[model samples]
Target: MRILLVDDHAIVRTGLRKLLAMVSNAEILEAKTGRESLAIAKAQPLDMIILDLNLPELGGLELLSRLRQFGPAPILVLSMHSEPIYVTRALEAGAQGYMSKNASPDELLTAIRQVSGGGRYIEQEIAQALILQSAVPAASLAQLAPRDLEILRHLAAGRSLSEIAEALGLGYKTIANNCSLIKTKLGVTKTADLLRLALEAGVS
Candidate 1:
């Protein structure tokens, strides 16, 4: 099996590499950035992609959408984010499976096997959360795209618009426009309200 591992952390990639060795004769490829992973996926034939949500240049959900455009390999999101919102968005973006980093190695292997076999998998706890979330009112936060959510998270972390633009590799005007759009979507008129919404959603 040829599996591409996408993560920015070297230590995490090293650990995942060792864990993936359990797959018989598995050939693992590594990428430390979203751009690098997208290039690899476009250039190489891969059986599966194990992706992390936190990435440079591109957010994980956006990367998954682009990968689905041409890359046929099934994507399994292996992320530190275990929130139902994150999980639901990833699956909506084309991930075949979603597993938290806190999952046991055994569960990780199980997710890999299930996804590689053309089946879907979600961490048990996340699946339950999704079910519960469906029983309640869907927040406007759920309407935001992955990048928008990322921007909101940065805002909630106390980043200025310029700082967010630099961190996201975008222009200041673009960030400002996005903030305007986000405000419209959430029915807020001030940055403070956006921050409050982000905090309430646990996006930070």
Candidate 2:
């Protein structure tokens, strides 16, 4: 099997290459950013992709969407954040599997094989959490107001507050006030933290 690994950290790529070496006869290709990964993917045939969610240039999720435009190769999201929300969003965005960086070697191997073989893979704990969340009635979207929801969604998509305000035709102070209300309702301390939580929850 051939796999492409995309991450900004060379150490992570090296470590994953070593681990993968122990289990399968896989040909590995590495790229340090989303643009490089896309270039490599377009130039070569790959059975699967191991992608890190937090990237320097284009984010893993955005890259996943772009990759889907070209082909249907299974993507296994390897993220440091284990929140079920993030896992769910990746899957929703066309990822075949979601696994954390903290996973054991065996777990990583299993996920790679599972995804490469056309199967879905998610950690058991995350799966259970998703199930529980599904059972609960989702909060009404009206609670936050449409404008606030729009700002939150842009934030979830990695837009800065200034960018969000400009995009939405709102004043900076107005957007900032809406953001404060969002934080109060969501119980988030900072905008970045709130965005992370929103991503994990698949809000956008």
Candidate 3:
């Protein structure tokens, strides 16, 4: 099987390559950012993709959505963020599996194999957390106003406040106010915390 490994870190790609060598007949392609990953995906026929959530040019969930727009491929997210929110968003964005970077090599091998075989995979802890969250029937995560949602999406895509304002045709002050409101509603004290909350809630 052919796999694409999308991560900014060379060491991470190398480690994954070494681990997968033991489990499957896999030829790996590497890309450092989401833009490069999309270009590579367009040019190659890959059986699966091991993606990192914290990409430089684009967030992993956004990349997953873009990839799905063209075709369906098993995307197994291998990320450092183990929060249930990140896993749920990855899955909702069309990822076939979600595993933490802290996972054992055997666990990653199992995830890759399962996802490549057209099955869904999630870490045991994350899976249990999702199940528990489902039982609570809490308010929707997209509770922000339309402007806040737009800002959240841009933030999730790794855009700065000024960039988001420019892209959305809004004034910098207006965008800042909206962001402040979003943080208040989400009960987050900082942009990074808001991002974490948005990812968990699967806002985009």
Candidate 4:
């Protein structure tokens, strides 16, 4: 199996390398930045990619998007951020599985194997969080894209569109478009109702 590990820390990569060695006849490659990971991913076909959400040079989600464009390969996220929002973002960004750093080594291997075998995996805690969010019938999380969810959170936190655009390093027009999409998806034509939905989703 050819597996590419994407993480910024030498120590984390070292640990992951040892754990992934459990794969039968595994050939592992390492990258310390999102850009580096994207370059390697484009260079060859990988059986799997284990990535961390946080990275330098390029954002991990953006890197995941770029890698997905190359074609299908299991991309498992190993990260410290285990919240539902983060998990949702990772899944929406094309991660095949999400494993929190707090998970047992056994779970780590299990998630890797499952995703490599063309299955999806999400941590139990994250699953429960999503389920809890689903208790509200209106403003379904499914309607929002990852980026939309992010903007929703910002809006719920009392950020203006200009502030959100500056905070996310995006154009004001882009942020406005995303906000409009969020409203359309959530079936809320009013900004106040959108904020209420965001709050209901526990974004605030």
Candidate 5:
């Protein structure tokens, strides 16, 4: 198996490399940034991709869409966020599997096997959460795209539009426009209300 590990943390990559060694005949490639991962994906064929959502410049959700244009390789998102919103956006972005960072090594291997074999997998706890969340009335958070969610998360963290633009490598005007769109979608007239909603939704 030819697998690419996309994560910015050296320790996490090292741990995953060691864990993936359990897969027979597995060859691993690593990238610490979204740009590097895109370059590697474009330059080679991969059997599977293990991606992390919290990349340096390019967010993982956006990267998932871009990577899908490269090949048929299945993507398994390994993220710290186990929220249903995160899982929903990832699946919508074309991920074959979603596993929280809290998953056991055994579960990680199972997720890798399933997704690489053209099957879908989600962490047990997260799957349950998704089910419960689905039972509730859909809200504006469900209407937000992955990028919009990222912006809301940053806003909940008390980041200004300028800071968010810098972090996302977008223009300030773009971020401001997105914030307005987010407000419209969420039915809020004020940024403070948006921040409150984001916090209530556990974005921070």
Candidate 6:
């Protein structure tokens, strides 16, 4: 199998190349930045791409969206962050699979194989963690409007009310009110509890 290993670290590429080679006769190509990755992918067809989200030049999500235009190769995101927001964003941005860097080597191979086979994979631990966070009543999360959910995600990331307001282009009072309502709907009395709930839900 042919695979592209996109990471900024030379040691990381070397380690991944060695591991991937052991799993299969993979012709692994490495890229240090998003531009190089795109160039190599456009030049020839790749069977899969294992990507790191914290790239140097280009943003990982933007690169992911652009890579979707190149071909049908599944993009497997290998990230250090197991936060809900990170996982959610990667999947939402078109990742075929998501695995935390802390995953076992065997799990890594399984995720790659599943993604290559046109199936989705999420690290078992991460999946279970997210599931447990979903212990809120049935449709409890479903009750949230998309905007409220988005706000919740920002909150879980430790963003201040003003920061979230600025980022969302809403007023401070508006965001404060929204947070109040979110806390009420979530049945949490404290800001910390709301944030904890959001994190449990894999918001970040």
The best candidate by lDDT is 5
How far in Å is the alpha carbon of 146 misplaced in model 3? Answer: 14
Between candidates 4 and 5, the one scoring higher on lDDT is 5
Better of 2 and 5 by TM-score: 5
Clashing pairs in 4: none
lDDT of candidate 6 over 1-204, digit per residue (tens): 789999989998998998887878988899999889999999999999999876765656668878888999999999877865556667877899999889999999899999998999999887876666544532455556546766776787788998988766679999899988988898888999887766656565
TM-score of each: 0.93, 0.70, 0.73, 0.69, 0.92, 0.67
- Residues 1-204 of candidate 3: C-alpha lDDT, one tens digit per residue: 788999999999998888888776678899999889899888877888899877664667677888776556789998877655566666777898999888888788888889999999998877876777642212444354434555786798898889987866678998899888887887778888888766656544
- Residue-pair clashes per prediction, in order, are 0, 2, 1, 0, 0, 3
Judged by TM-score relative to the true structure, which candidate is superior, 3 or 5?
Answer: 5
Candidate 5 C-alpha lDDT tens digits along 1-204: 899999999999999999988675799999999999999999999999999998878888889999999999999999998877778888989999999999999999999999999999999999998888742323658788778988888888888889999999999999999999999998889999888777655566
Worst 10 residues of 1 by lDDT: 131-140
Across 60-115, the per-residue lDDT of candidate 2 in tens digits comes to 66778787776778999998866554565578779999888877878888988899
Which candidate should be chosen as best, given TM-score against the real structure?
A: 1
* lDDT of candidate 6 at residue 73, scale 0 to 100: 95
For candidate 3, what is the TM-score? 0.73
Task: Give stretches of model 4 more than 4 Å off.
Answer: 134-204
TM-score sort, best first: 1, 5, 3, 2, 4, 6
Which residue segments of model 1 deviate by more than 4 Å?
134-138
Question: Which candidate, 4 or 5, has the higher TM-score?
Answer: 5
Residue 56, candidate 2: how far off, in angstroms?
Answer: 0.9
Report lDDT per candidate.
0.86, 0.77, 0.77, 0.80, 0.89, 0.81
Query: Per-residue lDDT for 40-84 in model 4, tens only?
Result: 888899999999876654556667778898768889999876656
Write down the worst ten-residue block by lDDT for model 2. 134-143
